[model samples]
Target: MTGAVLAERTEMVDGAPSALAALRRGEPVVLTHARERHLVIAAERVTGRTMALLVRYSSGFACVAIEGERLAALDIPLMEADDAGREAFAVSVDAGAGLTTGISALERARTVRALAHPSTTPADLVRPGHVVPVQVRPGGVLERPAPPEAAADLCRLAGLVPAAVFAAIPESVSEPLPTALADLTTVRVEDVVRHRERAEPLVHPAAVAPLATRRGLLTQHTYVDVRGGTEHLAVVAGAVADADAVPVRVHDECLAGDLLGSVRCRCAGDLAAALDAVATAGNGVVVYVRGGAACGGQPTGVAVPADRDRVAAHVLRDLGVRSVVLLTDDHGHAGRLSAFGMPVVACAPLTPAGQCDLRAGAVE
Candidate 1:
């Protein structure tokens, strides 16, 4: 009847019967710990219905609460006591009540736990092979089953399986099964090829363009012209070579902050500054390109054909401009520009005061 006694009883039962099973027997167990009794019920029995139960303690204590089928299945009481007795039972119920429900509970708990803490599932930890369930969405509803090879390949990549590494294979051309199954360790050759394929088009030098908007200002925009078999630099040229003579502020699209306003980087600020600079130049160009990475909180882009720095270099080289002032929030872009024999000025340290002065110069 006391909380302590209930806990001792629950612990005493080696190979303890499930609360759900006990509820089916019409003999619901009263789990006691520290002179308190917590009611246990079969979740399945309460399915599609709500039930009211009384929680009691040895110190002549009691509380009443309502519970639904789903909550019962989760073994979590909807309402608990404000006292120590209820608090103690809550811990035991969370740990002991749901193990018998099979994979569903484990999966649900995995998701719930992941939201609060970084955790890996048994699947994440085991080497089940390179194969994983390929779904249209990651952690989304599965529409079609993954191909055997794709599953195996995923397993290998996850270290769930083992196999030989081979040359990278393109996801578009390669058979998903064989390509994925070919290797189960490191990044799959197919994955590497797929990454390269995705990245090549975005990073290729010829895919970029530079334009001068006004007498002293410029803007550059990058694009993927999939319409023609050849990559077109039309957008950049059109913006820069507009019959105006304004200075240009060549800006790369920052997928992270420009679109999402990620606080980690000053992508959006740089973009706004570029546009204002070009406008002040009275006739300038602003070349804008898509961010070269995926959309994420991190200061990096997703897999793409060309990186923003590479596109900037291509635009600068085409203009034949010597010692152009390159502005970017990230210093990483500087190293990238160096490879193209371009000079880079990391605009990171420029304060708002400095930016204001630069904008003034653009107008002058």
Candidate 2:
């Protein structure tokens, strides 16, 4: 392409309508910073195809970022404790003119405070969340801003509303960013959340069979979120129909512990215990959230706690469960479920001595 054509395309991308148009169509735009190339997509529009494309292009890491205003709109609670008891979703931003490449507690608290009130100084303009580390064997090279100026620039140049930034590096050099600028793929925020019309999950029912250890039958059903492209598994043992206060274990997916028998965590053992406990009770369910594994051996990335909880609740309601006994600790899970009037019993995994405690604080 001639410089004239390239300049025209740049002008189109730099135009406000250009960015909004790409985002509305669910496409990502190329963003260059310090000669490092990155793909900037709207956070709300992330989908399976977009993720696949990112995986194909990324060098290693990708993170979803949001502006301070958007973070405030999420209504996340302010930090209730010091650094020792900081919350998982709590993120920090630089309120003053300073460097913030790494996550700092003081910065996080200040960011929270700043968001709650008017800023004494202008923030550098971004915060990050839900980082997914991508590994590309071969592909186009891609990179994102250390402080998120690149994403902000893309949003500004494209005239797209800047709520959240989904930034990733593509790996291959064979295909550079589109010169046309308007033909990028984009999706709506509803696509990522699977809200309302897109909330229905694709269900796959597996065969039921008897288990020797539990002395009962087990049936597996997989629920795949069409919007997020993540799968959650449900294991039903015995009968669960019209079962009130069913014994339920919302186990996080553990690849190393559950499969490789890693001793660093009790995930594998706890999973088994939950199954035996449910079988002994003669009726219960185990909703295994795919993102829970502590070790990396699985492709499923971590799900935001809030989004995961909501999806799990939907699965339970569909299974005819009204109330449940949560098998693990994570008060956030209990608190969220409780709001829906679901009575939850936070229990610890059985000890090696064959004894267990129910009144424990946040079991692993």
Candidate 2, position 124, lDDT: 43
What lDDT does candidate 2 reach at residue 192?
21
Q: Name the runs in model 2 displaced over 4 angstroms.
A: 1-214, 292-303, 340-364
State the TM-score for model 2: 0.39
Candidates in order, TM-scores: namely: 0.28, 0.39
Point to the candidate with the largest TM-score: 2
lDDT tens digits by residue: candidate 2, 128-213:
42242121111001122132433433343344444233444544543544444335543222112222212333333333444455
List model 1 lDDT by residue over 33-94, tens digit each: 22222332222222111112211111212111111222233333323442322211221121
Question: In model 1, which range of ten residues has the least summed lDDT?
Answer: 134-143
How does candidate 1 score on lDDT? 0.32
